[model samples]
Target: MAWSFWQIQELNKNYDLTIVGAGFTGLHTAIAFKRKYPKASVLIVDQGLGVNAASNRNAGFACFGSPTELLANYQHLGRDAALTMAQKRREGIEFLAHTYGKACDYVPVTSHELFLDAKHDFEHVVSELKLLNADLKSVGFATETFKPSLNAQLEINQIEICGEGQLNPAKLHNALLDNCRAVGIQFCNAKFIDHQLLQDDIAVELEGGMIIKTTALVLATNGFSNTTNIKPARAQVLITEPIYNLQLEGNYHFDKGYYYLRNVGDRVLFGGGRNLDFETETTTDLSLNEFIQSHLENLLRNKLLQNVPFQIAHKWAGIMGIRQDGTPKVEVLGNHIFRIEGMSGMGVALSPVLAQELVELL
Candidate 1:
């Protein structure tokens, strides 16, 4: 395809920094970088025209860490590493709240981790709550971060995590976009194909036969990254039709946080069954899996809603970058090229601080 003179002229423009992927990391990084270096020419290129994947597709929980999930982190990562992660998440949450304020519809709510019969031993989990709470307290959480639930309506063994919340992810995306634009960050709607390092710059090739040059490049593709260390993990979700007089109102998780459910107003937003088919769910495809979808519906009906009446409202899927430590992977591929991915399904609570770190590196 032949390019017009104006298009060719635009392509010739060089940016001090060109970031690929307009998700949370990219936008936040651009905002932070622009704030740090106001005179630098910055541009953000994204595949999606609006609110790129994962950032707007998340469940919108503003939680730092649940009891069971933190426990798993403690077992896998060492104590110091786990505590560090928890502190980072807490810092991210605080930053998000302070930055966006009430513009994102953030509502403070308690978090719960259900202990299912036969699946999880109540005594074993409750016994570990003290240790978990102590560790979390060291990271600036409440002294009793995890405690036995007192809500009698739950009708099961559960642990309550204090001071967690939920919010509108779409609103947060819009806020980021507005902030980036206000700070003079340019945007291009195109898919990134590849990049090549030059003597003093990097040339990025995008879809539709355009190559742009920049002094530095950042890859925040996350789940969509081509790096071997960051693999895509698809999370399928379904929400029920608004039920009259719905009682469930807070964020919840079970089965080591593979299954999560929350009440969005009167409707229940349920997701997670990748553990059922890990091999197939490890893909970038946004298409929902029938096997996983069916499992989620079954749990929603029998385990969650029970006799309550409701109808399936909608179904969707989002991809997340996964790693063993559930932390952001920052790598410097070259002097001018850097890559940031592997949020491990915690991108929402991790991106803000990661972006700051990237800006400092620059």
Candidate 2:
């Protein structure tokens, strides 16, 4: 549906900045900019309902990476690149905590990935430790989480702890939205943004065919970002109805970060598996794919929750924008337009940090 510009009986006011998408990135960017220049007129426009992207639809893990995930990271991008990426994520999580605090259901539980294989891969374990420890030492940190004795408890394969964290994305979004309102930032419920660029000023053409002119423009709408250079990836997730005496703690990632599950009180929230059918999952639609949902349920029933009993209460999907070029963009695209995105699936932590970074640059 196209946007019908506010039928202002008709009067238009100039804005200093206009942000696209009210997701975390867009909302945070709005707050960040308003904070720096209180006198600036800031407004946000989006095509969807408020914060409906991955920002609110995520599993809420406030973490950097799982151990084996980091080892795989090292293999893919080498030690240096991997550590740099890990460090940014850690900092991003810290920034999120500082920004929202416990009122947002921000819990700091230690995340541990269990390695339970019938056969022990001690060699793979040693290689993982060497590379991971080197990466950690690069930042003057250490994790004895992989030490043999305790290692036996987690037992099975290679392990390394990235100290990743989790949080309630919706709660965080609500807080940011509240903050933006309190500070007097203007926001429209929805806008199509048919065209945008900075010739002299940022011009955002809405689906309603109304053109809003602002001094600058920021693109923060993850996944559904296809309105511009940003591309959306659909992520499907399922949650079980409340369970009794569920002992799951922190966040857990399996098969790299492709499969993840964690306890949200008595309910178990789990998602991921885009690796199963990347071709189909690469979409902006929030519709569920039966194949992914069935795969998730199968993994839960046969692998993780074999001994546990539960019933699925709800299932839904969210869109996450991929940094297709391998770079999470946060730079000037034109004279006064800034594009900030590409957090992969970890927007729970990365978005807020990118917001602050965007503000500093502004």
Please list the C-alpha lDDT of all candidates, in the order they appear.
0.83, 0.72
Q: Which candidate is the best by TM-score?
A: 1
Candidate 1 lDDT over 1-362, as tens digits, reads 01111122244359999999888889889999999999999888888754447987888887777777877878888788888877887888888888885878888788898876666866888888888888788879888878886446657888887877888888888888888878878888788999988888998999987888999899998888886788899999999999999988899988888888999999999998889999999999889899999899998888788888999999999999886456665778889788888887677778888888888999
Best by lDDT: 1
Q: Which parts of model 1 are misplaced by more than 4 Å?
A: 1-12, 50-52, 324-326
Per-prediction TM-score: 0.94, 0.88
Global lDDT of model 1:
0.83
RMSD of 1: 3.5
* Residue 126 displacement (Å), model 1: 1.8
lDDT of 2: 0.72
